[model samples]
Every structure is written in structure tokens, then in C-alpha cells.
Target: MSTTDSTATCECARAVAELREELATLRDEVAGLQRENAALRDANERKAERIETLETHVTQEFATIRERTDRIERVGYTAVGHAREHAQWMRKHDRLHDALKSRRERFDERLWDLETGEIDVQDVIDAGTNDLPIQTRTKERKTNPDALRGNKKRSTFIWPEFYARSRKTSGGNLIVTTPDAANILAEAGVKHDNETTKRAMRFVARLSGNRDDPNHEEHLIRFEPGERGKSPARLVADAGEFEQFAREASGMDVTDSENDETDTQDDSDDIVGAEADEQMDTLLNATTEGS
Candidate 1:
């Protein structure tokens, strides 16, 4: 054979060997890529499952929250409704109380007139004393030897004036609001929000016995302490509490249990009533430190 033909045949065989080696390497790379792709696909499926679980949990939580909120709203609405109902009932109770009080007053007045031929001496005293215009009224001439100035005419309120006013104005079934009471005191030269009003309330704290029988001016005024700084005060009467307490304290109480009868406690200052200033002179006997 020729040398050129032999060399050509050798080159062809070498080229075939090189081509087969490259094809095997490509197959190995493809098999590795396929395994990696399968692993990635499995991981993606797990992540999808986790995402679905989270979504379900969030939905359930939202539903529970919505249910609880609805329940709270219902409870709030119920509470509001009950409060309104209670307010209405309270108003009704107040009206009934006023009607009954007026009727009782009328009956007492009638009975007293029939029994004694006139109004009670206390009423006469209250009316006569309270008639003075509040602006011009002065304190009763003091007889206190220890007082700094015994006869100095100063603006003050004592039991007599308050008793007189309260007696005269009570129970046309008058429900005196704090503003109304303040106005009454203002006419007597008292400031609406001053310490004098508080002092007057304290002075009358011992007068709770007025609830049982109209003696000792206990029933003349009942000071109710409520919402002291926040709202205007309201008046409330404790039925038998003050009367019972007074009985227990004195060890012996002289309450008028006698039937509709007028008794002149002191005829010296008769209920026929002289000048208001003169009547107050006799009031020295009623004065005390507690007052």
C-alpha cells in the first residue's frame, strides 16, 4: 500500500475514538442534572404544602377574632339598653315620690288645722322669719360673751333661717336641685361655690331626725352628698336611719308621739311671730358649736 493511504487510515481511527469519549462525558452531565432537578421539584412541593397550612391557620384565626368581636358588641349593646331602662325607672320613681309627698303634706295640714285651729307653731315661725328679703337679712344679735364681736351684723346662715326656708318651701313637693339650693343661699348673700355652703351642710348634719317627725328641724332638710366635685349634688332622705341614730345617741329622746296636736314649745316667742330680728334673739338657746 502507498504511505499516504496508511497515514489517512490512522487519523480516521483516532478521530472516531475522540468523538466517542466526548459523547460519554455529555451523558454523565445530563444524568447529574436530572437528579438535581428531581430534588428541587420535591422541595418545591413541600414549600407549597407549608404555605397552604399557614393560609388555613390565618383564616381560622380571623374567623375566631370576628366571632369574639361580635359577642363583645352584643354585650355592649345589652349594657347600654339596661342603663337606659334603669334611668327611666328612676325617673318614674321620683315622680311617684313627689305625688305621694304632696298628698301627705295636704293631709297633715288639714289634720293640723282641724285639731289645733291653725297651722303648727313651727310653720308660723318659719314663714314669719323667712319673709324678710334675703339681701337685707343679718345675723341675729349674738349674746356670746366669748365672741370677738357680739353684735356685729355679718352675713351668716344658722339653723333657724335654713329651717324656716326649707319648711315653707318643702313639699309643694318641691325637689330642690343643688342649683336651686345655691340660689336660695345666694339670696342670703352666700356664694354658690363657697365654703359657707359646705359649712351649712355640715351644720345641718345632725338634723336627720326630721325624717320621722317634723321636730328639731330634722325633716326640714336632708343634705345628700354625691358627686361632690364632679356633678351638682342631689338630695336624698334616709327613711328611719337618722331618727334611729338620734334615739340611740341621746339614750333618751323626747319625740312627739302625740296625735295631730299643736304644742307651743316656748310661748315667750309665740308662733304669733314678732319681727324676724327679734325672733332670732331667742334663738341663742338653739345655737351650738356643731351648728
Candidate 2:
């Protein structure tokens, strides 16, 4: 063979070897790039999931905040309405305050009308007088309401016969124990059923400031731990709490309102004076401006 032809063949083989090496390097680079792309996709998916979770949590938190705010506003508005109504009643009843002999003035003068009582207890109950569960006595002054009353303070000194009365001048509660109170009610009236004791207990409990009940403000007498909780016992009266509460209702106690009159009086706002037209003629007088 010629020398030139042999040289050309060697050069061609060397060129082919160089091309093969270049192809192998290009394949390695492509594989590395594919691995990096897969890693990037996985990272993006994780970030998206975390964002969605945060959004859901924020939405729930905002909803909870709105609900609590709405509840507070409702309570505030209701209180304002009640206060306005209370003041209106006070103004309206003053129309006949100047009569020579008012119904209440006569309760003070029990001369000829000895047999006819000052107030009809049944009529008062039937009229739904603030829906109170308490049954106070008018024994002593016969005209006086109870110990809770300001001018009639000496009244209710002798409590109901059914209760275990406490004649303590320091003024303790007139109580009948939970079981005793229930048994007595059951035996007294044949109109009640098997659930009479339970119903009566709950009714009294709710009105007398049961902690769980929403009507904690309507505490006419004062009791604790209604039928729901562990201490299912009943309380007939808490003299101190009742005295303070009744005085507040009749617009007598205002020392607490001295600092910020509007705020404190508003805070203590509650509906009263529902016992007027129910033959409890003195109730309006007691509710208006007490002595």
C-alpha cells in the first residue's frame, strides 16, 4: 500500500475515537440536568401544601373572632334597651304619686279595712311579675312586703310556716333543705306530677342565680349549683345578696356608679317593676323610688 493512504486511514480512526468520547460526556451532562429538575419539582410541591394549610388556619381563626364579637354586641344592645324601658316605667307611674290616699298610702293605714289584705298574693303570681319564683311573706306589718323592701324593712320578719325560719336580727336565710322543700311541694298540691319536685327545683334555681344559667342577673333571692352540676341542692334565700340585689333593682344603691355613672349604672342594668297591676299595689311604689 502507498504511505499517504496509510497515514490518511490512521487519522480517520483517531477522529472517530475523539467523536465517541465527546458523545459520552454529553450523555452524562443530560442525566445530571434531569436529576436537578426532579428535585426542583418536589420542592415546589411541598411549598404549595404548606401555603394551603396556613390559609385554612387563618380563615378559621377569623371566623371565630367574628362570632365572639357578634355575641358581645348583642348583649350590649339588649342591656341598653332594658335600661330605656326601666326609666320609662319610672316616669309613667309618677302621674298619680300626689293623690291624698294612694293604694300604698292606705296599706300604711290599716284601720277599718282589717280583713281585706293589702295585696293579693295569688293575683301577683298569676300576672307573671318578672317571672320570680320566690314567695315572700307579708305577716308583721301586713302592709309591708319583706326584708328586701327598704321602708318595709321590718316586714317579712316572720317567714312562711313551711320554711325553717331564722329569726336572727342579723338576718339569715329562711331555708328549707333541697329534699325537704321538694317533698313539701309535692305533698301540698295534688296538681303536680312525678317531675314536680324536679321542675320546681330547676325553676327556682334558674331564677335564683344558678351559675350555669344565662339569667344570672335575674337573681331574685340567690342560690347556687342548679340541677346540672354536682351540688344539686337548693337555697331558699341568701339575705345579704338579696338585700343588695333588691336595693339595686329599685334604683336605691348607686355608690358603685359614683366613679363613672354611665358605665357602672349601665353595667348593672336589669328589668324590674313588673309586679304593679297584679294587686301588688305597693310593688309599684317599692319599684319606683324606695324609702
Candidate 3:
């Protein structure tokens, strides 16, 4: 009703209006925050679902991998077992082959002795000459006059003296009949007189076919002296003679057959032996490494 009272009323009205505006602003901020919180909660739920799906897929992949690994392990174990079995088989085969080879060797030696007089002389002869004849002076002259002219001829008188001085024929029992055998004997290159006779006796004994008779014991061929002191050519001739004698005595041709069989057996044994050795080495290495 006075001027001062009116001014106080006006101030109160302005304050009330300001307070209402501030409350309205606060309400709008609260509404915006609530909307943001609801959107965040939805996004979090979607992320949780995606994470669960990813975990399931990873678990399935791991299970598949584990299954495949188990199968591979089983296969590896089976392969190792098979390898061991094969190794054992190879060892057994090698042992049997060796035993059979030994038996075959003994049988061959006995059979060779039975068929021939004592040794497989045929093999020695076959190795030496191939059944070629020994070339003689007369044969050479007949075959090639130029060759005959180039070579010198010794006198018949010299032959007797040479024979007499030779150590091979002490009592004239050793004869140089075959031209080949005679050439072989002369070429032996014996220095000592006693050695010459001994060499001659050995040559003659090889030539003579009296191995079965015991009365010709002194005439028997001595391999040791000739084998030790003889030249390569003489040794070859002697070997040929022995081989010829063996072939004549033995009615069967066993050399080639025996060689073929021996080669086959050797190949088989080599393969088996190699496999067995590898297996043994593997086992030994494993043991050494504390496997």
C-alpha cells in the first residue's frame, strides 16, 4: 500500500522466476544423461553376445585341431611299429643267408674235391689260357716267316747241355714234351741249379696225369715251390694245366652255374645286411640317447 512495500514485492517476483528457469535447465540435463545411459547399456549387451559367439567358435576350432592331432599321433606310432618289424625281418633274413652261404661253400668244396682229384683246377686253367695253344718256333715259322726271321734260334746241342745242367730233371724223369709247357719252364728264370730241377719237377708233375696213383708220389706236383718262385707266365701255364686236368676229370660244367648263384646270393645278402645294420645303428643310437 506504500512505495517501499511495492518494491519488495517486485524483487520477490523476479527471484521466483529465476529459480523456476534454473530448475527447468536441471531437468533437461537429467533427461539427456538418462538417454545416454540407456544407449550405453544396450551397446554393452550386444558386445557381450558377440564375445560369447567368438568364444564358442574358438572352442570348436581347438577341439577339431585336437582330434586331428590325436589321429596323426596314432599313425606315427603305427609307422614306427612297422619299421621295427621290418628291421627284425631283415636281421633274420641276413642271419639265415649267412648260414646258408657257409653251408653252400662247404658243400661246393666237398663236391669239387669229389668231382676233381683235389682242387677246382679247372677254374685256375680257365683263368689262365682260355684254351689257347702255346706258340712254338715251328708253328711261328709256319704262321709268320717274318716273325720267325726276327727271333733267334738256339742249337739242338745247346738243348741237351741245357737239360743236363737244369735242376728240374735230376734223373731224366721230368720231360719237356709240350711246346707250351716247355716254353713256360724255360721262361721261369731259375738262378740256382737245385731250384731249376725243383721247378722242372713241379712243371712235369702238373703235366703228368698220375695224381690218383700213390706209386708216383715223388712225381706229384708241388704247388708251393712254383707258386712262390715261378714267373707270372709260368704260373699262368701251370694253372691252365691244372684247370684242363680238372675239366677232363669233372663231367659237369659247374663253374658258371656256381658263379651265377654266388652273385645272386651276394646281392641278396648285401641288401639284407645293409638294412639290418641301419636298424641296429638306429636302435643303438636311441639307447645311447636314453630313448
Candidate 4:
């Protein structure tokens, strides 16, 4: 072989060797880049899973908290309602207690006065008289026109005269003849059915000397004039007996008692009198000044 040809062959062989080395380096770099990309993808997937798990936990926690808060609010509202009810009940209880206390005190005072004889039977009669209607005749006339009219056929109209004459009677005995007593007896009879009438008749018989003592049951029976009969006045005197009779007759207590009636009348009278007096005084003063 020629020397020039041998040199050219050596140079070509060296150039081929260098080119192979460069191709191998490029293949290694490509494999490393593929591995790095796979790792990054796995990391992204992990992050997505973690975020989903956190979101689920947060949603559940919020729901539980809301439920607990609602329960607390309901309990608080219930407690507040109960407190208001208790406060109202306490107010009513206090008012009732005060009313009962005042009634008890008044009753006690009355009883003490009776026991001490500071309040005599006559005083009771006077009290009853004070409670009676002042214009009884006027009231009776309004209620029963026939009673007020004088008729020869009616035996001189005895009831009105009897009531008028009885109004002037003195002491506790005559007090029973008052309109108040009659009204009380009538009310008792209405409330108690026949029981009140029976009790009153018995009381009258006792008071009329048919029975030995006024307090005894045996004294309650009325004997016909010579035998056994009921006395209206005697029956009216016993307030308890009359009340019991009223309950039996009417099935209730005498709600319109003389005391209540008197109080109502007095209130009405005060208002009317005040107005009349004011007007009268104004008229009189104006007349005098003009004169």
C-alpha cells in the first residue's frame, strides 16, 4: 500500500470513533429527562389527592359545628320562654296572696269586735240598716206597681204599709223587718233550694219560743200558730241559716249581698252628688253676682 493511503485510513477510523461517543452521551441525557418527568407527574397526583381529602374533612367539620350551634340556640330560646312564664306566675301569686291577706285581716277585726261586745247585736242591726236601700219604697214601687196601688179589693194594700211601719222599728229584732233582711232571705232561698227555707223556718220557730234555745236543732221546727209554723223575721235574722238556704235554692252564694250593693250605690251617689253640687254652686254664684 502507498504511505498517503495508509494515513488517510487512520484519520477516518479516529473520526468514526469520536462520532459514536457523542451519540451515546445524547441517549443517556434523554433517559434522565424521562425519569424526572415521571417523578413530577407522581408528585402532582399526590398533591391533588391531599387537597381532596382536606376539602372533605373541612365540609364534615362545618356541618357538625352548624348542628351543635342550632341545638344551643333552641335550648336558649326555651329557657328564656320558661323564665318569662315563671315571672308572670309569680306576679299573679303575689297579687292573690295580698288580696287574701287583706280579707283575712278585715274578718279578724270584725270577729274581735263581736267577741269584745264592742259591736252589739244592735250595732249589727244598724250596720244592716246602713246597708239597706235608702229609697226602698221607690225601689219597691218600681218592682211591683200593684203593691204600691191602694185597692179596696186587696184588703187596703197591707204589704207596703207593713214594710213602711217595719222600717221604723228599733233594735236588732225590728232590723229583721228591713228590706236588706228580706233581700238576703230571698237570695238564700234562691241559691239553696228548699234547704234555706227550712233552716229559716226552724230558726224562726226557735226565736218565737217554740224551741227552748236558738242554737238547738229541735228549736228549728215551726209549729202552726198553736202548733208549729214558720216566722219570716226569725228566719231572716240568722245570716248563716239564710246563706245555706240560698245556696240550696240557687246553687250558688248570694253574690249581690247588701254590703256590695251598698258600696256600688254609694259610689254612684258620690259621682252624681259631686256633679250636681258643682253645677248648683256655679248657678247660685252666677245668680248672686248678677243680682
Candidate 5:
């Protein structure tokens, strides 16, 4: 072989070796880039799943908020309408007041006539001159048509027997444990259902003015741990709460008396006068300016 030929062959061999090294380096770089792209794709998939979960949670929360807002709006509007109707009723109370005044004056004259032996007691009863007098000798007061229409309307809401018999000089807390007490409340139209009792107990608890106390139910009823049916279901209330509930629910006076037999005939006439005066005062107040 020639020397020039041998030198050219060596140079070609060296160039081929360098080209092979460059190709190997390029292949390593391409593999590393493929691994990195795979990792990035997995990260993006996980992030999308998280975003979808958050979207579902937010949608449920928004729906709950909207429902609660609608309920509050309905309750607020109903309360406003009730207040307006009460105001209208108060305006008509004045007409009843005038009629009650005339009735009272006639009652006084009749009583004077009876005391002076000018008229018999049976004649007073038979003549129908003493219809629905604000007295407590009977179990219930007879509804009188002779009274003004407004008076009749008001009477339908409030009971005359309860008003005449149950008014006390002062108020006190009530611990209702007896069946008699329950009967009195039921007769006056106050509901004693489970839901009503729960609401009433909750209200009494709020009267303490503390929101953090969760055991207020304990104060309302003496309960057995395992046997709820054996629990002593008692209604307890402060004076003001009792009066407010009694007047609002049945428009009747609340008495602590456990039985109807406690009422005597001697006090019936006096109760009549006192009840009439109180009724007159209530009528006058309702008719007051801007009432």
C-alpha cells in the first residue's frame, strides 16, 4: 500500500468515530425530554380533577344559600302582613268600647233595682237581661248578639270565662305538672303537642339570654336517659313569658288553679265588675292615637 493512502484511511476512521459519539449524545437527550413530558402530563391531569371537585362543592353551597334566603324572605313577608291586619282590627275596637260602656251603665241600674226589692232575681235571669255578663258562675259565658258586632268579633278570639276568673293581682312562674293544669290550657285552645312543647321549651331557654348553653332542654323536662316515654314532661315559664303566650295563643287569662272547683259563687259578681273594667281599658288602649 502507498503511504498517502494509509494516512487518508486513518483520517477517515477518526472522523467516523467522532460522528458516532455525537449521535449517542443526541439519543440520550431525546430520552430525557420524553420522561419530563410524561411527568408534566400526569401533573396536569391531577390538577384538572382537583378543579372539578372544587366546582361541584361550590355549586352545592350556592344552592343551599339561595334556598335559605328564600325561606327567610317568605317568613319576613308573612310577619309584616300579620302586623298590618292587627293594626286594622285595633281601629275597629273603639266602636265596641262605646257599646260596652252603655251595657255597664244598664247593669248598674239593674243591680240597684234588685237590691231595693223592686225586681226578682229569677225575673232578671228569665228576662234575658243578664246574657253573657262578665261573671264566673257558669262553666262558659253565653255569647251575646246584643253586643256590637266588633265586640262579638273580639269575643270570638278571647274567652269571657277565662278573663273573668283567671286574672291575678300579680304574676308568678308556673310549673305545670298536673293533668288539671294541662286540661285548663287545652280548654283555652293552647296546643300541647310534641312540637309545641319543644318550641315552648326553646323559648324559655332563650329567656336566660345565653346562646352557648346546649342543655337548656334539661330545665324544661325531667327526662330518663334510656326511656324517653317515662320522662316527666313539664312546662316551666317566667311570669311574663306565661302571660305573653296565654294572651297570644288563646287570648285568655292564665290561672295557676289546678281545678275548676276552686272558684266560689261569692266572688263571681266582683269578678264580673273587674273583668268589665279591664275589657274597657283594653278597648280604650286599642283605640288610642296611631295604635
Candidate 6:
């Protein structure tokens, strides 16, 4: 218990103090590491939330874009259909114009003859210019006994050649039936189902004044009941009104009335047709621009 003992006690005390200090430093380092790990976990959670939000926004935007694209495609198809219809209308108008022009030329020739003393002007004016009728082997019986004295019979239809040429080959008498209406409607790019065809037939019958007088075969149109009552009655357009009625069936630029004396009517019709064409072009251009 002398000097050696005193030195050993002092060394032991110093070692103990050093061990305690090392343990404290280790605890501090562990605490700091735990804090850093917590902060990193919070940052990762926030990043995950942000990614989810971005994904949702992108999904919604994509859906909106898809819907817009579908709408645009439907509109483009509709525009194309309208354009086709307008083209058909223009063709019909051209045919009418040609027919009218030919008639005018014929009248001019007659006028020239009168001016050159080749024919009397009054006689030419008085002469009827009715179109030739369809030939029949058997003469129709007269309805009245008093009016049956003459052997000669006259034609009921006096329409232009264009309408007469369009007559159905199978019908006993030339006329436009429901199938004919459907065909004409199809040419104008319109869907001609049963309902639409029937509607058009009724409209034509009403317009032609044939509905009020069903028995009269001289009207512009005639509706005949099915033989043996097996099917619905069918409509037949008069040879005179056939072409005009076909145009009307399309429900385009045609009207029930026209004033030939109006100065701006033709110009207005042309402008309307042009405007329709321009609208179709605009729709196509918009589709191209989007692409």
C-alpha cells in the first residue's frame, strides 16, 4: 500500500474516465444518425405523393384529349357527308339548266322562222308543244259513256324527256315507287330507311294534290293499294314531276315554289351552294390542322 499501490489506483481511475467519455460520444453519433434517417424518410414520402399527383393529372389530360379526338372525327365524317349531298344537288341543277336552255333554243328557232316569213307567228304561238307520250297497244276505256264517241285518245303526261327516261322498266305504267325514292336519296348521300322513304312518299303525294283525288289517274302522282291487300300502298310519281320530286325527296335546296321572274333567285341559290362547299372545306382544313 505504498507508492506502487498509489500509481495503480490513479491509472484505474483514468481508464474508467476515458471509457465513459467514449460511450457518450457513441450515443451522440447514434442520435445524429437517427435524425438524418428520419429526415430522409420524410423527403421520400413527399416525393412519392408528388409523383402520384403528376400521374393523375396526366391521366385526366389524356382522357380529355381522347374525347376531343373522337368528337373531331365524327364532325369530319358529317362534313364529308354534307359535301357529297351538295355535289349531288349541283349536278341536278346543271341538268335542269341544260333542259331549260334547250327549250329556250327551240323557241328561238321558231321566232327566227316567224321573223323570216317562213311561218306565221300567231299560228306558232297557238300550237301546243306538249311532249309525246308513252305508246300503248290497247286503248284505255273511257270513264263516261257520253265521252266515248271518239277513237282517238290523248296522253296524260306531258313532262320533259329527262323525267320520262327515268321511268322504272318493270312497272306497267311508268312511275316512281318507294325504291326509286330511296335510290335518289342514296345518290344525295342520305340514308333512306323505311321511315324516311315513307315520309318522302307522303310528302310527294301531298305536294302533287294526288291525295285528295285518289281515283283520278291524271294527277302528278298516284298512290295504288297493294294487290290483294298483302302490302302497304305504293306511291308513283308522275312522269312530269318525277325529277323535281326526286330532288325534293333529298330535302336539300329545293322548294315547293319558285319565282322565275325574281332577278336574284338563281344567284342566291348559287351562293348557298358555294357557302356549303366552303363550310365543308373549312371542316377538312380544321381536321388537317389538328393532325
**Alpha-carbon TM-score of each model against the true structure:** 0.31, 0.27, 0.33, 0.33, 0.29, 0.33
The whole-model lDDT of each prediction reads 0.44, 0.44, 0.41, 0.40, 0.41, 0.45
lDDT of 6 by residue, 1-291 (tens): 899999999999999999999999989999999999999999999999999999999999999999999999999999999999999999999999997897676467546534654334323232232211111100111122232111111111111111322455554444554555556555434445755565444433322432223223554555554554366545665443543433332222123113323213432343344344343232212111211
lDDT tens per residue, model 3, 1-291? 999999999999999999999989989999998998999889899999999999999999999999999999999999999999999999999999997897786566446544644333442453243221111222232234443211011111112222223233344332233233344334533122344433333323332322321123432233233333343222121333333333332212122325544234323332343343332232112211210
Candidate 1, 92-118: lDDT as tens digits: 999999978976975674475447432
Give lDDT tens digits, candidate 4, residues 73-170. Answer: 99999988999999999999999999788767656754654575422343234323311111222233334544322111111121212222223223
Top model by lDDT, which number? 6
What are the RMSD figures for all models against the true structure? Answer: 17.5, 22.2, 24.0, 22.5, 22.5, 24.2
lDDT at position 269, candidate 4: 34
In model 2, the clashing pairs are none
What is candidate 2's lDDT per residue for 127-171, written digit by digit as tens?
Answer: 354323232222222334243332122112211222232222345
Off by over 4 Å in 3: 1-7, 93-291
Worst 10 residues of 4 by lDDT: 150-159
Ranking 4 against 5 by lDDT, winner: 5
> Candidate 5 lDDT, tens digit per residue, 1-291?
899999999999999998888888888988898988899889889989988988998999899989998998898889889888887877677667776776676567456545654333433243242222212112222223222222211222222222222233345544433233334435645546543344333222322222212134423112111235665444343445534432332223212112333332222322343444453333222221120
Q: What are the clashing pairs of model 1?
A: 210-218, 210-219
Per model, how many backbone clashes are there? 2, 0, 4, 26, 0, 0
- Pick the winner on TM-score between candidates 3 and 6: 3
**Residue 282 lDDT, candidate 3, scale 0-100:** 28
What TM-score does model 5 achieve against the real structure?
0.29
Q: What is residue 121's positional error in candidate 3, in angstroms?
A: 16
